[model samples]
Target chain A: MLKLISSQIVSMNDIEEEILDRKNRKKSTNMILCEKVIGQILEEITLSEYDLIICTGEGELGQTYSFFSSLASKDHARPIFFQNSLHNSTLGSVSLQIPNIHLGISASNGFISYETGIEMALASSSTKPVIIVGIDAYPKELLEVKERIYGNEIKLKSGACGALFLKDSTSELFKSHKGRVLTDICFNTHCEAPTSREVFPANGLEDILRKLSQNHTNFTVNRPGGDSIVYSFES
Target chain B: MNPVDTISITGHGLISPAGIGLDALWEKCLSNNSVIKNGLGVIPKSDFSKVTQFVENSKWCKSIPKVKSKALYYSLFSIMSAIDSAKWIELNKTDTIVIGTTTGNLTSWEDSLMSYSLGDDKDQTIESIREQSLGQLSVEIKKTLAFTGKVLITSSACSASTQAITLAYQQLSSKRSVRAIVGGVEELGKLTIRGFGSLKLLTEDNCKPFDQNRTGINLSEGGAFFTLERNSDSPYLLRDGSTVLDSYHMTSPHPEGKGYQKSIHETLELSGLTKESISLIHAHGTGSFHNDQSEGFALNAIFGNQVPVISTKGVHGHALAASGAFELGIILKVLETQLIPPSSALVEQDQEIDLLLPRKPLEGKVTNILKATLGFGGVNSSFIVSRRDDA
Candidate 1:
C-alpha cells in the first residue's frame, strides 16, 4: 500500500486581485493561476526520490500539455515546447526535474480523475514516494459553466492547484508526527439522489480535515457522482 | 487472490458485422461463415456515408441506428443493447453500469472538423454532441439502466474494456455487488483516422493477421458488452484476469514481449493452470505488422506452437478500445459452442512465429482459454477464462 508523505496546493502566492486589476488584466486563465501555485510548491519541497508522478488539470486551455512539457528537462539554456503536447506533461515536466520517474496524467471530466491519481500512488509497486497534483484555473470564456458548477459569483479569478507526495504508511520518507491522514476514498458514478447537491471537490478534502479538527473522530463526506477524499487520524 | 468459482457471464449483447444479436453472430461463427466482406456499399439512413470512406473496401461495418453523429450512434446503440441484455434480469435488480470507451463520440470532432472545412453553420456544429464526453456517458448509462450501483467509465486506450472487466470482477468479488454490465464501445472518426494515417498503420484492404504479407490494420467501429454475475447458470466464467504496465514506452511494446509474457504467465499462474490446458488463444491480432509479430512472438515463447491461435480483427476490423471486450464476447461464444472460428484472412504463416494458424475452424472441448491485449501507454492485460461445466 502507498501513503502520501507530502502534499501541497499551489495558489496565487503574492499576486492579489488588486494587482491584477492594476495591471488591467481582463481575461482570467486558470493555467496562469496554477503556474503561481506550482511555483510556490516547487520552492518548498523536493520531489527527486519519487518513482511515479501524476498531474491533473481543468485549467490553461490548450496549454495544459506544453506547460508540463517545458518542465521535462531542467536545462536552463534552452526550453523545449512542442504542439499537441501530451495530457500528462505536468507530470512529465516534474519527471524531467527528477529523472528516472514514471509519469501519467488523467484529465477525465470529474472527481474520478482525482481518485484515480491517488489510487495509482497508493497501489504502485514502487517503494519510492509519489506526487499527485490537481490543478484547475478559471476558464475565461467558459465562466458561466464554471460558475454554474462551482456555485458562486465571487471574483476570485485566480485558480489553485495542490500537490501531495504519497508513500506507504511505513515508509521512511514521511517525518514522524507530521503528516496528513487519508481515511477513505470512494467514487460514485451513478448517484441516485434525485436532486444532486453542489458538493465541491475541495469539500472532499476539507471534510476530512474538518472532521478531525472538530469531533476528533472518523467522518464521511460524499463528493457525489465522482471521487470523495477523506483523512483520518493515525490512531 | 479472489477465487472466482461462482462468478459467471449471465448475459451479453453483441453488435458486429454479423448483426445486432449475440445469437446471430454466434450462429455465423459456428457455421464458419464470414460476415466480413469488402463493403456494404449502400446502407440506408446511415451516417455511414459520412465516415464510410474510412472502411470503403472492408465488408464488415457494425451498423447502429443513424444518429445525428456516427460515434454517438455507436455508443448509444451499445448502451441500449447492454440495457436490453440486462433486461434478462428484473429492472433495478442490478445498478452497476460500467462503460469502457476510448473514443467518446470522437466522431463528433471529426464531423465538426468537416463542418469547419466546408464552412457549415455554427448552429449546425457538432459541439452540441460534444456533451457526450466520457463523464456524461456515465450519466446517460445510469438513466438508461436505471441502475443504482456505481457507474464507472474507463478510457485507458485499448485496455479500456479489460480494465472495466477487471474492475467489475473486483466489485463483485468483494461482495459489494453481485451483478454488473461491463463492456466497451468505439467508433470510426477522422481524428483516429488521421492519427493512424500519420503513424502510417492503416491498411488499404481487409486486415490479414499472422500472414507474412500482412500490411496494416483497418480501423473499424463497434460495441460489445457482457452482463456478468457472481453466481449464475451461464456457460462461461471469468477464471482470472490481471493488468501490468510496461513502463517501457508510451506507444510501442517491448521488443522481447517482457510485459506481455509477464502478464500471461501471471494470469496462468493465478488461475492455477498450465499453457497446455488452454484450448485456444484469442490473440490481439490487429493485422498490424508489429502487433501481430510481437504478439505471435509472445504466444510462441509462452504456450509454444501447440495451442491454436485465432484473431477476430479480420472480421470486426480493429475496434481500438472495444477490441478486448468484443474478443471476450467471441470467446464466451466459442466456449459455449465448443468450436473456434477459422482464420478469416490468414493464408501464409511466418515460420519464425510458433503459433498454430489453422485454415479451418477447430472444434474441441475448450475448457480454458486465454485472451491477451496490449494498448497504448504500455498497458498490457490478459484474462484466463474457464468453462462453467469444466469447473
Candidate 2:
C-alpha cells in the first residue's frame, strides 16, 4: 500500500502568464509543466524528503516540432531544441532545480504513460517517499501534421499532474492522510469503463488525483486496447 | 531457508554496429578494431538491408501493418533472434515486453516532417506517426508477438535499456510476470547526431574511453534483446540492479559520480555481493571528458584499482539507449568464454583514473560482472550479471 501525501495539477492556462513573460522562453512546454507541478508539490514537502522522482509522458512533441520545423525550413536548428526533444529532458530540467535527489527516471507509453509512471513507482523498492510527475504539453505546431497523419484534427491540451506517494512503512510523514491511501494497484486488468480520448497523455492520472482529492475511493484507467489499470484507494 | 528465485538471462540477440549476432559482436570487440568510422558507429548498410529484408520476409510480418521505422525493424529482428535463441516455442499472454529507446523511429519522423515541409504530406500518415511514438515501440513488438500482458517503454536516455532490464528483473522477482522480453533499440538520426554535436560532445576520431586524451563519444546505432525468466537454467543470471539520479545537472554527471556510487553500492547490496566479488565492471565510459572522469573517480573510489574495468564504446560506439543491452550481450559472452575484451582505442589511461584498464583481452576465471550506465538526466543504473555454475 502507498499513501498519497500530496498532489497538484498544472495546466497550460495556469502558467500562461509565466510562459509569455519568461526570459528563458526556449524551455519546452513540457519542462514548464513539470516545473509547475513539481513546484506545487515542493510547496507541500521539502525536496530532501523525496528519494525518487519519476517523470512520464508520450514525447516532447513541442520541442520535436520546433527542431523539425527548423530542419524543414533549412534553418539552423537550435541545439537546445534537440536537447529538449528527448523524452527525459523534462526530468533532467527538473533535476537542475532540485539538485539534492539522486534518482530520477522518465518513462513513456503513449496514453498509458501516467499509469506506467505509477507502476514504476509502485515497483520501486525504495523505502523513502517517491514523486511521480505525469506531464504532456499540446504540440500546437504539430496540429497540422497530426491532422495530415490522423486524417482529422486531434484534440490535445498541455497539462501536468504530480503525486507524492509514500509506502505504508514510510507514511509517518503524512499520517494524517491515512484515508487517502492506495490499497492496491492492478495493471493490465479488465476494464468496465469505456475507452475515451484524453486531452493529454497524462490526463488519466490527473483525473484520478482530482477524484482522490474529492474523496473518491476507486479509479480505473481504461487503456486503448481494452486493458485497464485499476487503482483502489481507501477513502 | 526459502529457495532463491534468481532471474536468469536465458538468451539474448545482438544487432550492433560491429555486425549482427553475438559472435560477430564478440569477435569485433576482441579484434581491437573500432567499428566507428568518421566518428559514427553506424550499422553497415549491407547488414541493415539484410535485417530489414529478413524482418519483412518473416511470417510474423504478415499480420502487422507495414511501417517505415528502421528502429522497429531492428527491434523485431533482435526480438525474434532472442526468442529463437531462448527456444521459446510460443509466447504466453502473461509475459511482458519492455523496450528502451532514445529516439524511436525519428528517422522516419524526419522523413515525414521533411516531406510535409516540402509541401508533400504523403509520408505524414497516422500509422507512421503512431509507429514513431516511444511507447509504440513496445506496442508494435507486442502486436508482432501477439502478447496482451503488459507493455512498457522507457526513454531515459542512455540508461534506458538498463532500466528496462531492471524493471523486468523486478517484475519476475515479484512474481508479477513469469517471463519478460527486455532490451533497447536505437537508430542513428540527424537529431541525435546534431544534438550531441551541438553539446560539443561528439568525437572527431575513434572514441577512447578513460584515455587521458579522450575527446568525446561517437554516436552509434543498433538493438539488443534478451529473454529473462526466474530460476531458469541459463548460464547468466541477472542477480539484481538499481537506478538513481544525481539531481545535479541535466547534461553533465556529478563530478565525483555520487549518483553512480550510490547505484553501484545499492545494486551490490541488493544482490548480496560485495565489490570484490565483481570480476569486471562495464563502465558507461562514453569517452566524454566529464563522463569518464566522473566514472573513473567513482570506480576508483569503490574498487581501488582491484577490478578490471573496460568500456566498449570505442569498439561499438555509444549506442545511446541501446548501449546497456549491447554491453550486457558482451558480458554474457565474457561469462561463456572467460576472456575479457580489451577497452578499445585506449592509448594512455588518464592518470586520474586509477582503476585497471585492460588493453588486451584478459583470460581469467570471470564470475560476476557489474554494468553501469549514466544518462542525460543524471539517471544512474547498475546491475550485476553472474554465471551459473550448475548451468
Candidate 3:
C-alpha cells in the first residue's frame, strides 16, 4: 500500500513561494515551476527520508535548444550550464534545495507527464518518502485550439509544476496523516476530453488539486484525449 | 534485503536493422551479418562528418504501413508488433504503457525547422510544431490503438528504455497494475546525425565495440517493446534494475563509472544474486573510446573476469533508447537458445579493457542475464532477467 504524504501545485500564474534567487543559475521555465513546487512542500516531507526522486516532462527542450544548438557560439558555452540543461537537470535543482535524496530520475512519456509521474511514484514507493515531480509548459497554442473549438475566453496558465510525496501505505506516517489524498489514478488514453464539465481547471495538476479540494468523489480531467488520463480520488 | 520480485517478461517484439519481430531479431543475432553499414550512400550525407549514411528503409520497415516520418512509422510498427506477439489475450484499462526515446520525432521537427527557415508558410511551421514534441508520437500511438490506459514516457538518453522497464517492473511489484508495456525507440534524424557528427561521435566505419581502433557510434533507428504481465507464464523475469545519475557531464561519462557501479551494485543486491549465478552480461558497447573505457572499468570492478560480456550494437547499431529494449529482445533469444552470440564486427578486441568479447558463440544454460546501458546526462541503468523455473 502507498499513500501521498503531501501534494503541491505551481503554475506560471502562481509561484509556490520565493524560490532561491540565484545570480548565476541558468533558470528554465520548467525549473521555475519545479522550484516553486518543491519550495512549497520543502518542509512537509523530510528531505533525508526520500531515497528516490522521479520527474516527468515533455523533454529538456528549454536547455537543449537554447544552449546546445549554438554550443560553439562566440559566447562560449559553460559546461555547468550545459550539464544542468539535460532533461534530468531539474532534479539537480531538487538536490540543491533538498540535498538529501540520493537518486533523482526524470521520466518523459510525452503529455502524460503528470500521470506517468504518479505511476512511477507508486512503483518506487517501497523506497519510502519518494518525491514525484511533473512540470511542463503547455502549448500556449493549446489555448488557441481550445478557444477555436469552444469559442470561450479562458485564462489558462502556460505550464504547471506538481509534486507528490509518497510512502508505503503500510508505513506509520501514511496511517497518521489525515490530509487530502489521491488514489486509483487511471489514465485512459482511449477516451476524449471530459465534456461533462463546462468549467475546467487550469492544467493537469491543477485539475487534480481542484478535485481534491472540492471533495469530489469522482471526476475526470481532460488531457490530450478527452479525459484521456482519468483518476478516481478520495478526500 | 527482501527477495527479488522477479517481474516476468511474457512477450517481446522488435523492429531494428537486425529485422522485425522476435524471430527475425533472433535469427539476425544468430547470423554473422554486420547490420552497421557505411551510411554514405543510403542516408543524407552529414556536412560536418564523413559518417552520414545509416540504415534506411531497413527490411523491417517494409512490412509496416508507410508514413511520411520515420519516427512515427517505427514507433507505431514496433509497438503493435509487440502486443501481437504477446497474444495480449487481454489488455485491461489497468495495464500501463511506458515508452522511451532519446529523440522523438526529431527528424520531422528538423525538417519543419528547415522549411520555416527557408520561408515556408507559417502554417507549415505550425503543422510541424504539432508533431515536433515527443508527446506527438504518443498521441498518435494512443489515438491509433485507442488505448485509454495511462501512458508514461521516459527520456534519460540511451538508458531511457531500461529506466522505463525498471518503472514497469516496479509497477507490477507494487501490484498497482496488472501489465506494463515497457519499451523505447529512436529514429534517425538530421538533428541527431548533424548533432553527433558535430561532436565527432558518428562513425563512418562499421562500429567495432570494445575494439582496439574503435570509432564512435553508428546511429540507427528502431524500437523494441515487451509485455510485462504479472504472474504470467513467461520464462524470463525482470529480476531487478536501478538508475543513477552522475551529474558529471552531459556528453561524457564518469571517469570510473562511479554512478554506473552504484546502479549495478544496487540492482545485484536487489535481485539477491551474486556474480557467480549470472550466466552472461549484455553491455551498452557504443564502440566509442571513452564510453567503453568507463563501462569496461565498471564491469571489471564489479564481476571481474567471471562474466563474459557481449555488445549487440555491432548487430543493430546504436538505436539510442531503443537499444536497451532491442537488446532485451536479443537477450530473450540468448536465453531461449542458451547461446551467447558473437560480438558483431569485432576484429581486434581492445586489450586495454579487461572484459571478454566473444569471437564465436558460447553455448550453455543461461539461468540469469544482465542488460545494462549508459546514456547521456550521466545516466547509467542495469537490470537482470532470470528464468522463472530457476531454483
Q: Best by TM-score, which number?
A: 2
lDDT of 1 by residue, B1-391 (tens): 2453466777676566566656766665555454544521111234344233332222222332233344444445554555555555353433455666665656554344334334443644534333324555544444444444556565556776775676566556655455777787776654455556556677677777888888887776667777777667666778556665565655566666766787788778766788888989988887887777788888889878888898877766777777788788888878877888876577788666678877777888888879898776566777877897644
**TM-score against native, each model:** 0.72, 0.93, 0.83
Clash counts for all predictions: 18, 2, 15
- Alpha-carbon error at B96 in model 3, in Å? 2.8
Off by over 4 Å in 2: A21-26, A51-56, A147-154, A174-176, A183-198, A207-219, A224-227, A232-235, B1-3, B56-62, B115-127, B389-391
Q: Give model 3's docking category.
A: acceptable
DockQ of 3: 0.33
For candidate 3, write residues B1-391 as lDDT tens digits.
1244456887776667655566766776677466667832122223111111112233222232223456566566666566667786555677877887766777666555445434454654546644545666776665555565666777777888988888788878877777889898887765566666766787898788889989888888777788887666678888768877665655788878977888888888878898788889999998889899998899999889668898877777888878899888888888888888987778898888888778888898788899888887678888999876643
DockQ of each: 0.12, 0.56, 0.33
What lDDT score is found at residue B73 in candidate 3? 60
Q: What TM-score, to 2 decimals, does candidate 3 have?
A: 0.83
Q: Which ten residues in a row have the lowest lDDT in candidate 3 chain A?
A: A194-203
lDDT of 1 at B246: 60
Kindly list the per-residue Cα lDDT of model 3 for residues A1-235, writing each as its tens digit.
2355677765556743333456424666666776666767765655555654545444545554444335424333444444444566566555455554555567665445666666677566345566666666533424443333333333333454555555556667767776555566666544554433322222356566777677776677666434455566564
For model 3, what is the error of residue B17's alpha carbon versus the real structure, in angstroms, after optimal superposition?
1.6
lDDT of 2 by residue, B166-241 (tens): 9888768766678989999999988888778878999879999999999999999999999998877888989668
The list of candidate 1 runs beyond 4 A from truth reads A1-4, A8-111, A116-235, B1-5, B27-94, B113-132
